[model samples]
Target: MHRGRLFRPTVFIIISCILFLQGLSAAPPLQTGSFIRDAEIEATLHEYITPLFRVAKLDPKSLNLYVIVNPEINASASIRYSIFINTGLLLESKTPEQVIGVLAHETGHIAGGHISRTEGAMGKATLAAMAAMALGTAAAIASNSSDAAMASILGGMSMAQGIVFHYSRGQEGTADSSGVHYLDDLKWSSRGLLEFMQMLEKQEYLSPDQQDVYMRTHPFSRDRVDFLKQHLKNSPYANNRLPQDFYEKYDRMIAKLSAYLEPPGKTLLTYRATDQSVKARYARAIAFYRENNFPEASKQLDGLIHEFPRDPYFHEIKGQFMFEQGRLDDALTSYKQAIEIKPDAPLIHLAYAQTLIEKNQPKMDKEAIHELRNVLKDEEENSFAWRLLAIAYGRGGNLGMSSLALAEEALANDKPKIALTQSKRSQYHLKSGPDKLRAADIQSLAERLVKEKE
Candidate 1:
């Protein structure tokens, strides 16, 4: 299968090397992956929304956008002229109009100049107090990751409260009105935004975790919803409606994402479910899975697979689970089935490649080098692949080729992965020849070259 293991490890190796490899990264080190890929979504939003901002007298360039991956429902604009979005928010939003509305509101924060003024206000009045608190914050700097995050969050909240001037709820009100106006000017529908707000307002009654985070942070009150309704009443922009083509694209994107991210038995939640009851089940299944309810996850996966046996994605997820359980043969079979069903997905290739490397050492050593060579043919600057290929070469008894690759990795990233790949060469000066004689010869050569230059 496309994403399954290339081979099952012998029983002994499974107990030894497989366990050792998994142990190599027990505590997921700080995953500092690039946030650039999601920028495509931001760029698309910008292209469609910039004109609206222009008409509203906001500089599109000055507004810095940050897309963060936090599962929690939250958005903030205290320090940077930025919009930090959660992927969950994007997935859950019912429409593009609502997404644009949220952006408009954040833009309102920047245009309103909230965070800067607040900080400046504090600095002016209590330079001493702020300094003391800043120092106190240093106490939180003691090397615990959780403590540091809390300290930073507390620090930001503290400075925000005393020093920064927040645009009052009235300001939020004015922005809401202006934001809709901009949306209306752009001839985008306000229904989506209103619908989203109503959803949040209703959600306020539900458990905070069950509802979108917007309600909790945005400070929902009956007044805010009522006020929006009042403004939207007799409004020209209220008719901003989604086109049929837009729905088709939106549905397609949601389907692709659901197929990609959902585990087995997940009833696809693509802005709609087959039924409200089924949708609730889907959401609950996801919560259970996310909360580490593996039995529940398995149960849910089984249920969904039973319901939709024809769906290849479900089997793909089953393969993932089996792979995790060390059922290499089963995973391989499932992944192969998935590959037959969906051959074009790049992620499938990545998964298959990873599994292949994990299972068959001899095949992996040969295939990895071959793949890297082919990849280097197109893009020679791929230092990471080069490093891997170097290791493969070392495994193949090509020491010189391995060293050359190691040098490239070190030069490109300044951090060779580990000593396992002749890591000592990068670290210490080495020679099989007598070190004393080599040192003296190098010293003599240097002296002669230096004297000639002089």
Candidate 2:
């Protein structure tokens, strides 16, 4: 319930957002939608769901959570222990409890083995690819809500791919029942799920074309409502409310997303000038930045930083703003401050490393390489980090290490042939050492993968 952590921008990975996409063995790369990574949002979600996963006897570590940058009110669980949630659902939720409720339902799907029962028209690899395609790269840019919804939800594996990420009424009912039990066990209210269901009930009357993606996929029923209503009536924890502090955190999360993902004008309108709340000001600051009103944006951010100097996210965003504006020195200072506050955040380190690499100063290359290596420790398959590491190594005049990094990057990005070539180049340049051994290993793996393609 601690609301100390906050979101920072600039950790978007075309690959990391789809956590499983990088490890695909023989499958072709699928076009991915925009997925984002925010340390605070992901951490908050992890906090909310850890209990549910525990209650369900699911390994929290094995389960991956992804936030797709789409404005569709949908969430889905993959057969491979991954959960995908859209930004629209996060923004649409009235409270963190509502989000938790939905997540519990998804957890139910994972716990109940419903995902495996669903037809695998797409093989496990394809299914993983599809689930991953749901979120990746940047915010989804599809202009048409319907198309975007289907693409984001199904990862473009809709009817065209002969795949429907739907569940039967019975499965949904089981998930609802399981979700209710999980919440009840934790002494939390079931009202969040009930209210979310009731909210979707209205969409049932609409045509399939007009209905929200959740309705089309989840198959809502009055029986679901009646069952939840009955459970709430009898459960002792039925009236439980989330901590008041959580609501503020939830609002800040939503505000950050809206400021970054929504139209600048729309975000500004929603978080009006008169509303002096932290969340409101945060939204306005990002909106002003998006509008290119740097002065006003800096004013808002500076005020927030003055008030909350220790907040790493404030510094993180200030760094992002500065980096994007080509103010490398100012950006470096802010990013360094953010890292000083939250040293363990890999994404922030990744951003800082990227800025260091971009500054193009040889003296900083060593720092950039070190930071990139730290990022890879946490995110080994992060192709972006590998790519940045390659740049850092190249800048430091370590061609052998640079080639090895590029090979790693290529492997992560599913370009095994390129990996093979780069690994060979790396071996040619390096003497016998752990780095050379790594290059040899990459060569063998890449060669095998390339052969698998043939």
Candidate 3:
């Protein structure tokens, strides 16, 4: 079966190593761990956060949200309005409100300019400490040496403590107040924030090293919860309820994440026959798919499509299953339907293009090139799409375009030397036009990067 380089862990690891060696001259790309990308989940999160952003007087469109695959219950805000949320938090949250509450708190950090202020104070020292901690964490996982890991982390923290503006308790209080104000403005309850804080309260007894990353970064206090409680008691929207569909979407997001991340056997055991809800069935379908139970997987997916006929994501999942199972024609059909339902989703377009390239028919290759170019119009940074575009161009006998696409892919993947070579090669084949000018630009960038490395 032709694999279209989806979530290639090795590539990510290599990119991470390259970035580490290069040093943080610019903000290192967001390489925190495996990232989970799905159009539906992203849309849901956008819906959840847009109102909060508006309430906070921030532009919703400017914020970038990333769903990390880690199972830790943590969220962080970084430069450029980037917010990272862990899948574990979504799976563990009891209600949509709870997840929103966490997001609100993180948004509080963004609106209050906490991340930038902290970074300014710590400067390069903070980056160095983070690198040391990352190395220590990797060593701990590789060698199972908790003592060594703890020593490294504590050493890094200690070294940076003098310069780091470790958010004062007063800052935490301000964030809490800001979050509550956003919730109130949106006519949503602050109960979720209170409940989440109370849950973290149980971790107070644990040693600093034993605490989750959230508690480590956020620095919880009873007074923070009490302060929230006091405001919640007087807030006009204390008892408001989220929409019913909100719960359904939230449940499905959790189920999907659990199915994809957990062991197939474990997922199947957790979502049993008795629980016939849509989300449960979806999880079972994915678990069965992963286990290679093709018949059962198709059966569950068909049932979902039958029930929610217009849900584009269900169709997308079915397409993914068919593609993995080597049913190219059927997969193409399913992907087409999904795109028809949600034509604007770049991810769906990428998937469809990938399947088309894997099919490898000359006509399909041409179509895949068209689709990929369209995708690049909106998602220019997508290296996988660029890689597939290269494949498509090569298959269609467009050597110049193929070389240019390869250069773009290498650049996106941070292989400046490879990009430089490809860009130079493309210049030999490409005619004088916009494409050649673009190739020249890439060649210049690649040369600059190589010089920096030297």
Most accurate candidate by lDDT: 2
Candidate 2 lDDT trough over 10 residues, lowest sum: 1-10
The TM-score values for the models, in the order shown, are 0.42, 0.84, 0.82
- Cα RMSD for candidates in order: 14.9, 8.1, 9.5
TM-score (C-alpha) between model 1 and the true structure: 0.42
Q: After superposition, how far is residue 82 of candidate 2 from its true place, in Å?
A: 0.9
lDDT per residue for candidate 3 within 94-182, as digits (tens), equals 88999999889888988998864443443453333232222222233234454553343334333422322245566777888899889
- Number of the predicted model whose TM-score against the real structure is largest: 2
lDDT of 1 by residue, 384-420 (tens): 4455556566677767556656554432322223222
What ranking of all candidate models by lDDT puts the best one first? 2, 3, 1
lDDT of 1: 0.47
Q: After aligning candidate 2 to the native by TM-score, how far in Å is the CA of 372 from where it should be? A: 1.2
Q: Which scores higher on lDDT, 1 or 3? A: 3
Q: In model 3, what lDDT does residue 3 have?
A: 18
Q: Look at candidate 3 and tell me the lDDT of residue 447.
A: 88
lDDT of 2 by residue, 148-233 (tens): 43344345433222324678899999999999999988899999999899999888889888887899778899999999999999
Q: lDDT of all the models against the reference? A: 0.47, 0.74, 0.73
Give the Å error, residue 273, model 2. 0.8
Candidate 1 regions off by >4 Å? 1-36, 78-80, 116-168, 205-212, 242-249, 264-454
